[model samples]
Target chain A: AQTVTQSQPEMSVQEAETVTLSCTYDTSESDYYLFWYKQPPSRQMILVIRQEAYKQQNATENRFSVNFQKAAKSFSLKISDSQLGDAAMYFCAYRKQYGNKLVFGAGTILRVKS
Target chain B: EAGVAQSPRYKIIEKRQSVAFWCNPISGHATLYWYQQILGQGPKLLIQFQNNGVVDDSQLPKDRFSAERLKGVDSTLKIQPAKLEDSAVYLCASSLDSGRLTDTQYFGPGTRLTVL
Candidate 1:
């Protein structure tokens, strides 16, 4: 069984600051995918960023970037220039390279302070 | 394109009661999923359907849960004799395909269920 772990239960950052959320997974499969999802107060789950295990280059999408260390099974999300609107519950998820089922970690609630 | 849709934004029932939730996937999507997310936890896949056929249901608690997708379009998940531990938010998601390489699941608002 594969499991994702988000160590930070609650994170707070001031507007314009940078914050990084840590996530680690246990998987023996070489081919896999890592993802970060943001769930706003509306409870709508939105994709943040994605990383393929075979890719060496870390993936970045606008303000979101992932530091994926494949060998260590560590995938972390870094939010830069954070804005107030970025407040949400961020969840780190994992999927087998060939399976669509996503295994998610305990979410981290992010609060953007003014 | 519109995202996945789920019905009955919130539901409350007593222990041992039964409750059913409905989900409508995105148009043209061939894969649909049902997930259970309890407070302070990530969503857990309950069942998955690929064009109305069961793909994988290894994690589903079969004794108390059953889900069906009719004609590979819409789906319904029912829980009979609900228990307090069953209280959780039910999320419905759909992907363009069942194959992981091209799968990007879009999730719904989810139906929050509370059992007393």
Candidate 2:
């Protein structure tokens, strides 16, 4: 079975600064997808960014970007110019290229300090 | 486009009580998913549906939980004789097409259930 691991339980970042959340996965399949989701107090899971395993170029969405290293099976999310709204529970998820199911990590709580 | 919709934003029940959750996926979406999220943990997929047919329910606790997506749009998840361990947030999500690799899943405001 495929498993995702998020090492950081909590992360603190100052407004206007940058923070990176680490994620690693174990998978035997060569083709897959990775995603980062943010869940605020409202309990809505919002998509932050996503990366395809076959793509060499990392995926970037506005202030959010992922450093995807396929060989090492590490996918890290970087949040630049962190704002107060960025404070949430961030989760890393994995999905097979041909599968609809997503396996998520434990999650890391991000706190943005003023 | 409008996102997924879930009813009864919050639900409370005692042990051995029955409860049900309702979900309406995004318009035209072909894939719907149900997830259970315990406090301080990531969401776990409970069941998945492609239209009105079940795609996966392997992780679902069939002994007590049941879910169905009839008419290929609206879905309902029922829990009979709920247990304290079932206290968690239930999230519903939908994707444009399960067969497309680039399709993103949109989530609804999850229903928080408290089994006292």
Q: Chain A vs. true chain A, TM-score per candidate?
A: 0.98, 0.99
TM-scores for every candidate against the unseen true structure: 0.98, 0.98
Model 1: per-residue Cα lDDT over A1-114, one tens digit each:
999999999999999999999999999899998999999999989999999999999999999999999889999999999999999999999999897999999999999999
Off by over 4 Å in 1: none
**Which pairs of residues collide in model 2?**
none
**Candidate 1 local lDDT, residue B102:** 49
True contacts kept of each: 0.97, 0.87
- Candidate 2 lDDT, tens digit per residue, A1-114? 999999999999999999999999999999999999999989899999989999999999999999999999999999999999999999999999997899999999999999
TM-score for candidate 1, residues paired by index: 0.98
| Candidate 1: CAPRI quality band | high
Off by over 4 Å in 2: none
